[model samples]
Target: MSINRQIVLASRPQGEPSADNFRLVESPLAPPEQLADGQVLVRHHFLSLDPYMRGRMSEGKSYAQPQPLNEVMIGGTVGEVIASRHPQYAVGDKVVGMGGWQEYAVVNAAQPGLLRKVDTTHIPLSAYLGAVGMPGVTAWYGLMKICEPRAGGTISVSAASGAVGSAVGQLAKSRGCRVVGFAGGPDKCRYVVEELGFDACIDYRQHATLDSLQAALREAAPQGIDGHFENVGGMVLDAVLLQMNAFGRIAVCGMIAGYNGEPIPLRHPQMILTSRLRVEGFIVSEHMEVWPEALKELGTLVATGRLKYRESVAQGLASAPEAFIGLLKGRNFGKQLVKLI
Candidate 1:
């Protein structure tokens, strides 16, 4: 209890990420002797593992700044406030914030929008980091604001069984649109359609080649795709482009397939021009203004059991590296998380 455990990036990855890139270290759980005003100490219980973290590990031009090496890996954490010298926060309050990959954090309550208490009455505590947190917000903003679903229209989502994609499909369905998803395997495809209420689910692995993927997508989405919420950008994007309806809209949330390999190129860049498609890529963090409204709606859905989600949890902090590596390979199902408590 007196030592703070951390999972820090030991080295940048080459190709697919591995456990050897992360190093675990321990530091004394020490607080400042003279507490600054508005200071609070947090003990992290859960940490979110996401695909974006892969980008942070590499020193490359990205939408977000690279995470510093030899420091606790940057991530979202939900924890309890154990000590507070601030007016707003109090001991025992459950809060969600970016406390990184550490067991403890000392943050100033006056820090603008860094930490906030979460309501755990109707929603599960861990759900704050998954369904109603950043991922949920990402889904909401991308699907509603960017994709702009049309009722009775067809929407195709890639990485359909994971955190952001699952929310996107369900949300689109709620708008009276027919939603289809591209997941990795039969099991995930089944879950996307049967459990998450998607109209059709395509197993991308079953159709690895671009031609096969295009055929499968065409078969699944007979009407052509009106909107796309893309997660895996390699073959999935290519296939979707071929099936795109005129004036189709694409909300490019992530290109995870290229995270560990050579950058994926669009097989048909001309489709955007010929078909008059609207394609927009976004980083969720850059748009914080929409979060309040987005989280409110997403939270209500998850709490009422209308929005469904699943989590793949690793037991401890030490497991984050391996869990993260598996995430890049599409090994974990649903939302990947690490439980430090």
Candidate 2:
């Protein structure tokens, strides 16, 4: 453990990122005895690969600062404390924090919200990076707080098989709403309907045009969509707009279609005025107060087996770049993680 291995941002991407944008680097690790008073050494077990990280890689203006070149790529990590010079942390403590793309990290445990101890008795340590973590909280806040669906109403979700979208559908179903999902292919569509228990799942690829997608949505959501959770934009959003009921609420989570710098101009901007839709975009990190409440429900659902989740895991830290690229292309099923242990 004398050397720490990491994936650093080598260059900013122009559109789609390739392996050239990332570089693997190694650095000498200071011994436990040489650590500063408030610092702790952590050995990362798992690293999370999220879509939002793509936004951070660019130098453009964003909600958060862009990832600095030649630094460890920004990410969420769950690990074990190997050495501690802090009062609250001790060796073997299971914790979660922003440990980035490195196999090991030395961070100040004294910094509030930087590190947190988690219980693995009910939920696995890896779940701290997924369902019972940020993605789950993002789902809860967007669905419950923004797109409030009433019982017997219909809810439409895009990117239905993804980590956040899956949770949004399941949580909405629990509240007695008829949930319909929109996914890329037949296999993903089947999983969304049969496995995740959505009322129906539309294979968006089959309906390549806005009019075609709108026709399919009409059948799945016969009563019209009362609430919508959008993940993919472009044609999908346009179709959802056409089917939305009057005064329907929409929670805009992601626009992965435009992440590669493609222009996603809405075909029908006037639909918002005609439908009286309330569409709001949110960044989950900005609302910290709701996390505790969100995590409590998400943790219980996951622990009790009511909330089912999936993960596509890569073998080592070196595989992160490929795994992340695969995620953007929808090659990975469910939550994507890189195992560093």
Candidate 3:
């Protein structure tokens, strides 16, 4: 008897997505008889708005395919099960999965890589969509596996106050590596260093050029960067490459700086060969097997006051468009979420 409100793609975005690209429509809820055996009906509570979703708005193929036109925009969400024909999940159980930008969905329990029941007793259900979710796992596996920083070494991270970036800096610090972070403004830089416990943080907005960034980094870590967690590509990455020590490792998590179709030329290819640096680009979904272990470790760290997280939450689904626009514009302080009833 319930009807669902959903956000569907009205048109493919040429560059950054605007409110006009999304069309909110109403659809009749799936009938109980249509529910497959071991399927459940879920009402969405929290929706994740990520930078990667911007790539999905375009038609080009990358790590994941673009969302088809008129289809619901795909995203990770936390929801409450309203009706369950499945033995594993009961009514009122909270779960996290790819629920898209919709109010309700019928999910098949037997579907491979579907929803996972969350234990909300220890952490808030929203954490599953942020810290303990894909972003956390992305930070953990990318840094530990790709850029293995040794004790007494130095690691540098861009967008260091962001969800994944913040996690990377803290994890490196915990491992005894000196951490340096790069954020947009003075406030975020201060938060990264003072609140997030980073060894040092540079305000990229204040720096006029790559030379200034280099000078700042040199002062922060006299030994030079042994490992780099790259979230923003372009001149910043080029500058970092110039300061890397021999045999440095780079984990390429994202290219937020050039996400809006900016022209960013590769200026320092010689660093990879001359410095013997290993630069690897990774998609977090490829390392799904390690998620449980990462979650356990990160959960313990957060619960024990070792790991810290911050979220910038939008009040409702109607605010999702603005929140997403802000996220792309670097307006969000941390992980951005849309809280929907």
Candidate 4:
């Protein structure tokens, strides 16, 4: 039997998650000959660490149930199929799925929408967990379906250098919209503007107060924001609300500002009513029908060198906890991944 190293949630987080909240354990994997019908075993190469996992960690009433304690932490993974009993998958097939924080996973491949084989000829296999995967579809859904940004309109993105936000900015730019991004530090802001091709990017660190942030947005988006993709809530949302044009569309994705149990009260709630703004919240997982369409466009953009993204990979399964904590605190740049090998 081959031993598999995995990370499990040791306890519910009090505020921000720490190293103590997670535990590492080993489990024995059955050999390929023992696999049941329709089963496939995958050896994960990279594990995706995202903000939504924080919500799943809590026992609160959210869209999904809390992650069971002492169980493998929930996450997206990209890996190769080491063994397969399913007709659709082969032993050497590269796959992407919700394999959690484990080195290997045996999944029932026959289950619909559970596992997907990806082509790494042009797009890297690791990208299946980020730009060409869930985050990319999320950006497409919120920007195209909800915001409905028109050419020449201005679009604003918070947490702009992150996986979803970075994709959102690029997609908005491709649609001929003026893209403005908000990131934590100068380096991320510079990358958003210079590399990610956003029209302008504001470093939220420089503008601590809501007034200052809104003033910066006013200068960056003089035409007024027609649509906004919100990742971080609280002050950032409030600031964007202040500069929004009439009838602007706001897509609420993640409220990472309050992920640590802190309050994220919006300073300006009246803007929605006065400006006739349309604010809608969504969970990308609930909309599986759009995955094919979204992935097609995102894949082309990535393969052709039009859509650009970055990653901050932590080495080994032992590094997952610390890397995840850093991700929640906005410490990691681009997409945060654990290189499990």
Q: Which candidate has the top score in lDDT?
A: 4
lDDT of 3 by residue, 148-230 (tens): 97899999999999999999999999999999999999999989999999999988888887788778878987898999999
Regions more than 4 Å wrong, model 1: 31-34
- TM-score, predicted candidate 2 vs. hidden true structure: 0.99
Task: Report per-prediction Cα RMSD to one decimal.
Answer: 1.1, 0.8, 1.3, 0.7
Task: State each model's CA lDDT, in order.
Answer: 0.91, 0.94, 0.89, 0.94
As for candidate 3, its clashing pairs are: none
Error of 1 at 58 (Å): 0.9
Clashing pairs in 1: none
- Compare the candidates by TM-score and give the number of the best one: 4
What TM-score does candidate 4 reach? 0.99
Query: What's each prediction's TM-score?
Result: 0.98, 0.99, 0.97, 0.99
- Ranked by TM-score, the better of candidates 1 and 2 is 2
For candidate 1, write residues 1-341 as lDDT tens digits.
Answer: 67899989899988888899899999987764545789888999999999999988888898888888888999999999988898888899999999999999988889798999998999988999989999999999999988898899999899999999999999999999999999989999999999999999999888768998888888889999999999989888998998999999999998897887687988899999989999999988889999999999999999999999999999999999989988888989999999988
Which digits, one per residue and each the tens of the lDDT, describe model 2 over residues 215-301?
A: 999999999999999998989999899889999999999999999899999998788999999999999999999999999999999
